[model samples]
Target: MANTPHGGVLKDLHQRDASIQEELKAKAETLPHITLTERQLCDLELILNGAFSPLEGFLGKKDYESVVETLRLADGTLWTIPIYLDVSSQKIAEVGIRPGAQITLRDPRNDQALAILTVSDTYQPDKEREAIKVYGANDKAHPSVSYLWDHTQDFYVGGSVQAVSEPQHYDYVADRRSPAELRAHFKKLNWTRVVAFQTRNPMHRAHRELTVRAARSRHANVLIQPVVGLTKPGDIDHFTRVRVYKAIMPKYPNGMAMLSLLPLAMRMGGPREAVWHAIIRKNFGASHFIVGRDHAGPGKNSQGEDFYGPYEAQDLVLSFTSELDIEVVPFQMLTYLPDTDEYQPVNEVPEGVKTLNISGTELRRRLKTGAPIPEWFSYPEVVRILREANPPRHKQGFTIFLTGLHASGKEAIARALQVSLNQEGGRSVTLLLGETIRHELSSELGFTKRERDINVGRIGFVSGELTRAGGACIAAPIAPYEEARNKAKETISKWGGFYLVHVATSLEQCIKNDRTGVYAKAQAGEIKGFTGIDDVYEEPKNPDLRVDPTQTPISQIVHEIVLLLERDGYIGER
Candidate 1:
């Protein structure tokens, strides 16, 4: 939900409300006057769908006009400030809006629409002023996969228009600036080289020592960039982590470092993530990104050993240096030397300096039980961060992935399996076939590649959800190729007992039994690049159980799968 792309909900709403469509087109026509482009228009439509649909009826009579006026005020700005709304707020007056919408800011004294004000060149001198402008999708979705990180009028929002100083839309900044923008901002301030620290956890002596070392070694400014959105399960929440960052900022070298939020998501990948982090920092304008041990790691696999060692992240960055302009500054694990009353790298400590090594897990445990972290473990400032980032440990579950081709009877097989697994009793079984989830997850303007990735990603989420609930998942998606199937296999296998049941339906038979008429469309070029016809569908070379939908009855297919699970020790014999 944190990384939810805007406009997905608006497109859905526009289908039901003809007025919204008219309003969108009107805004698009007027958006350019306010600096909104064609792309921003599309993005605004999406953001409307994602953010404002549920509140359609709740918006009062005067609110619509306020929205329109807000847009008028935010004219010609490349970056549009989003009109922030609180659906939970009681009064519509308490809510905010941009131009093109019929809403006005609430007046507390009069309990009526605030007097319409002209757009100001400066930030809104009045605290209550709002602005409306269409923000570009690029700004809404920053840190793109490829290059091109510019702080331009690419981002917009739905709200009243006000002066730049006041940020007329929402009262608070929706999010912090992107890394690229931060670098540009600092560069303007005369800071040339920056050392960006990537963190999901709070600062401790080890982290502090490494960061300090990075700054000294690289001769660069330090940027404490912490992820503020959905990290791996059990990680600390954003609010608490921000407080920790605030507390520890004073301890850092003055004028040599600064703190900011990285409005990005984390993928618990170790080596790949290291490369990703480096690239992100490069975009954010960092000259150097600190690659601490096990950087961006998700911990152990099923074997309970580390997925990658600390040096692996460093190695991953070194492996791809020329491409990513950012330098990687790697530092060994830091340990505290009590006798000397200082922190030192594990290798640098003398045999006599009362040395100690305390892990993050141990630190958290002590905190949860209201115990003191050893003085040698972390700085008092750093320990304050640990206190702020203390989150409850959550036990995650496993996911079951099912893949095959369209019309390979994937849905039928998935449904049958779901029923069978449910009948097994005591085990929670949830079936998420491709079609149903796609309808719920996908958008009209969604790109083919993103759609494909998201479709598969949703299946993975479902699998993780089902498995975590201590239940089983039966996901049947037309994976179409060995690569996708293998990815599904690998992702699910991480949870253990990931039975890859390949629904081996012949391509000819699938075309012959086409339920959605996709095959016919593919042949006529009506549907470009359809799988198994114009495109290829690689059959699974090896699957735990291969069922020919043409030959096997649905009942028998389900029984065989259940048998495989039981035989493989995933389920008890029944």
Candidate 2:
């Protein structure tokens, strides 16, 4: 039998009529809009499509508080993650946002309006408290907790949403299914007792074995519902993962398995996130969810400690199974028995039998070094796809981001580094200097902190694209702030290595090195927002490489930076 949707209702919120969509879009154009970030875009889609059933809109204060404190909604329903629309106070006040205000939510990819929200309540979240309760720690190491403290704003606005249109996704149209659509598909196929497998990473042989085992044990068909929305940072891009999924589709026996996509911006809240995943699967008509060891875990914290116990996710999901209306199918870790050429549960393996398993870190090492991935560990086709995506480190791209005070000699280092990179003669090296970027990209922008961040963002975008291709990019900017530099790192690291080189040149030396006399002009108040004069240059707490240009020669500094890159395997005698 098909499981009931959460709250016993599938809340598909999109308006179907083309004329009505046009009318709503026209109306939304005149209302004040809060542009949804990429993360918010992912959440809005699920909420609109009933994958997050019972969540008609962003959570109100009561629901948020209830979920944070107790993992239950105000009505005592099992709801784990706190989902809300975070808007900045400046945007709120500029647009006169308040209770009873009707506002439009615009997509950041474009200015197109997706929904109209009737603001019911606005409140400042106790972010640290929420982090501690929901994530089990107020540590910045947690991805969502970091987002809450860094990227999220002070105000959260909540209300019911009137969907004008669904966010447009050009890719993977066929596999993108709303909860209602998936339920209908299951009904059409006469599939009862569906087992759902959730993953953000690309699957391999062991994963296939475990899912097949879980499904057969439960007498259920398999549903591979992988997250296509924002996954954990540095995860394999969904396009490659989807291709890998397609390659594995034929591996399933008979017609027991199907694939679909979920646009969930994961909070990485571990145990809480597992319960949330189970609930979502139940809504999508899955009777059972496969919760494996360390399910949805974010690895380790900065202190080199596991954030949660290995079994915590499965335990939490099992505890709530009765209320969730879904069965939790627990599976032990899988390893290969090479003698038999089969996979089995770790606990069931005989003591004398030899077993093999490849760790993620080890796999990455093998990939970087172009080592052969054993067939038992992964399918050749899947490995080929991964290899295409992740070339050997020497052939892959990378970025060197240099930041320092004005006249700090970072520009000279950037130039020198670019020259050293090009000396290899195979990789294309591009240098982006802040002064040149100011002329080229930020000509209209000013010296304000916000403007500086925008300039840095532009530099990051360009360098990131350059790195995405098979090239080396060196960018020197007086980025001045950790937030902007971190943003740059986030962008570039998605494609390739992002090395942050901090030129720790003293202010006095920088002034002495200033032949242009800009520092003198800044002291005379001609340059208002001069960094290290009237403005601040927040030093990077843990830059990959910190150099003193005043003490180290340019050639030696460039050599040190290159050695750092080579040691990390971005370049070598490949």
Candidate 3:
């Protein structure tokens, strides 16, 4: 028999009655609408599809309090996470939301209405309490806690929903199965026992071996269910990860495994999250779930200590196995043994046997350096997909940001570097000079602190976009503030390499070299709030490259920068 859904029944909220759906569609225009955020959309999809088996809609205040404090619904059903529809005061006023009022929930990606909510109540939630009780910390270092504090709205409105349509997904349509659909699939396949492996990261050889071992040990087939929703901020995008997953699927024993995508917004809540995952897998017709070491752990805390013990997730899942109605298969840490040419569980290996393992950081470093990843570590196809998504540094995009005082030779060096790069002719180069930006991007913006920040932010946004498209961008600006420069670096680094070059040309030297008399005017107080005069110019404490135009010739400085780029593999060897 297929595994039973959570809470003994799968709650499908979609309006199957064609007439009722048409009526709701007609009423939707008159009803007030709330645009759902990315996380809320994930929640709504699960609720309507019955993946959140017992939840027909977002939780009311009573159920929210119960779930947060006791990890159960008000009716005493097991539910670890609190799902709420939060709105701002401005939105509440615009919609005039209150008990007994009905509103349409519209998808933010498209304006299509997905569901209708009849409001049961609206109340402010204690975020601090929610963070501490549910996520085990009130610290912003925890990704979910930071989101609760930063991204969530002030008021939460709760009610049952009447779904009009499911959230439309253009990608992987066939693989996005609902709870009922998955149960039907299992029934058709006659798969009596299934073990699920859940992950947010890309699967490698070790993960494959571990999941296969779990299935073999339990005499069950494998389900590779990877989360495709909002994961950790820097996680690999689902598009790339799904490609990797598809590449690795053939390695599984034929007819012994299957792959599916789960659009779950993970909270990284460690032990509690592990239990929650098991319940969700049960609803998907999986009889067992693999809870690996540090499952759903958010990694190190602010003090650099592991947030949860390696076995904490497994232990917690074991404690709730009876009530969850799903077996918790504890993942064994596996490492490749070079002599045996196979992976073995670390605990089962002989004491004197040599073991080899690659850390995620080391894997990325190898990828960036174009080094070979051993076949023992991952399959060639998987490596190929990863390499395509994240090319070698020399083939990737980058930004060279130059900051200095006015008339400090920044623009001259920037122009020279642009010419040199264009002459080299491997990739397109874009130069964003301070004057050009002021005239073009920030024409109405002045030199006040806020305006200057706005100017730098606009430059950063453009640079980031260019870098993402594999182009080289050189930005020369009098970005005197450290915060704005750092913000630019952070934004650009997400897409490609970001190198900061500080032109540490002295103020006295800049004044001496100023044939335009701009510095002289500033010194004479004719120009107020000029950098290095009335306004301060905060020097970069540790820039990637620092140049003094007075001592180093422009040609030599550019040569030095080229050498830096070459050394970091941002360009080919000279």
Candidate 4:
């Protein structure tokens, strides 16, 4: 029999009544709305769909504290991760949020209302405690901890949510299923024992070996559950990873494996995450879950130490096995045995026998260099899918973002680099100059800080698309603020290599080279909120490269940048 769901019930909260849903939709329009971030949207979807089986809404203060401190809910149910509805103070005031008030939760992507929350409590979270307790580290190197401190807002509003409608996902609609739906699916398939595999990465040969071994050992079918929502930075996008997953399905034993997409925003909270994953798999009707070494672990902290012990995930999951309902299947490193032409556990291998293993880093290096991945490491189909998404670095796309004061020669160098790239004769090159963007894309925006950030973000968006399509993007924007520039870098870095070049032209030099006379106008009060005049410019503390255009000609400066790109594997030999 399939394992029971967490909390003994699937908490699918979507409104069933058309009239009530319509009424709620009507009321939601009148109430102030809070726009959910991508992570929160993922959480909301899981909540409504019962994938987060017991969570009907974001956690209240007591539940939040309980989950953080005890890894359980207020009702003493085993729940590891805390779901939050974090919002800014400005948003709080805009919504007039209070204990009794209702706030509509809207999807920013489509401007549609998804749920309504009766505000139970609003309070500031002790992020340090959250980081330390939930992630076992208050270190910024942990992606979730960094998000808590940096990207997350100041306040957390908690309540029970009433679903107006389920969020629509157009992509891979067939594979997305609620907990109840998936349980029904398991029943229909007559699979008594199901072993779910949790993955956020592309599956290689070793992964297939371990999963197949797990299923055969347990006498269970395989449920390949992969995260489709936000994962760690620099991870492959879900679209590409899904294609990779789809390609690998045929390699599994016939009718032995099935694919399902989990809209989960991973915390990378090693042990806690493993427990949480087991619960989710249980809700999905899986009888067992495979917990490998360092499952869901974020690599390292800034202190050069691992956040969790090597086997902590397996240990923690084992500790919660009886309560988790889903069986915990422990896994170890599988090595390829050339002599037997199969994979075996390291401990089972004969001493002095030749073994082959490819590390994830090594695989990525091979992909970037277009090096051959032996069939022992991955299937040819899987390799082909990965190569399509991650072409050789020389054929890949890249973005060069130049930031400095106005008249800082950013535009000059950008145009020169654009020409140089054009002469190289491979991919198309686009130059997004500050003045040109302001004139074309952001005509209505002024020189205010917010407007400048928006302008820079626009350039970043366009650059990301171009980079994704395998073209060179040169964006010369006076991206004065670090936060916006960082946002831009985050936006483009997912698609291809993103380099932030600080055009280190001094304020005095800018004034001297002011052919446009805009800086003079700003200083003379003719232009308001002009950067480096009425406004302050924050110098980049960690730029990829810094160049002084005053000290070198544009051609030489472009050459220096080309050399940097070549060094970073963004380009190849002339």
Candidates in order have lDDT scores of 0.56, 0.88, 0.89, 0.88
Error of 4 at 432 (Å): 3.2
Worst 10 residues of 3 by lDDT: 1-10
> Model 2, stretches more than 4 Å misplaced?
1-25, 400-423, 433-439, 442-460, 475-494, 498-566
Badly placed stretches (over 4 Å) of model 3 are 1-15, 508-534
lDDT of 2 by residue, 1-574 (tens): 1234642212323424667657777999999888899998888887777777777888889888998898887888778999999988898899778888999888888787888888889999999899899988888888888888999989988887878777888899999988888888999999988999999988999989999999889899999999998877778899999999999988999799999999889988889999999989988889899998888887788798999998999999888766888899998999999999999999999999999989999998898778899998999999999999889888888999999999999999988887788887668999999889999889999988899999999999999999989799999999999999999999988888899989999999999999998999999999888899999999999999899988999999999888988897788787
* Per-model TM-score versus the true fold: 0.42, 0.84, 0.94, 0.87
Model 1 misplacement above 4 A: 1-175, 350-353, 381-574
Itemize residue pairs with steric clashes in candidate 3. none
In candidate 4, what are the lDDT values of residues 188-226, reduced to their tens digit?
A: 999999999999999988888899999999999999999
Q: Which stretches of model 4 miss by more than 4 angstroms?
A: 1-21, 401-416, 442-457, 476-491, 498-556, 568-574
The alpha-carbon lDDT assigned to residue 488 of candidate 1 equals 63
Name the weakest run of 10 consecutive residues (lDDT summed) in model 4: 1-10
Rank by lDDT, highest first: 3, 4, 2, 1
Provide the lDDT at 440 for model 3: 92
- Considering every candidate listed, which one attains the maximal TM-score? 3
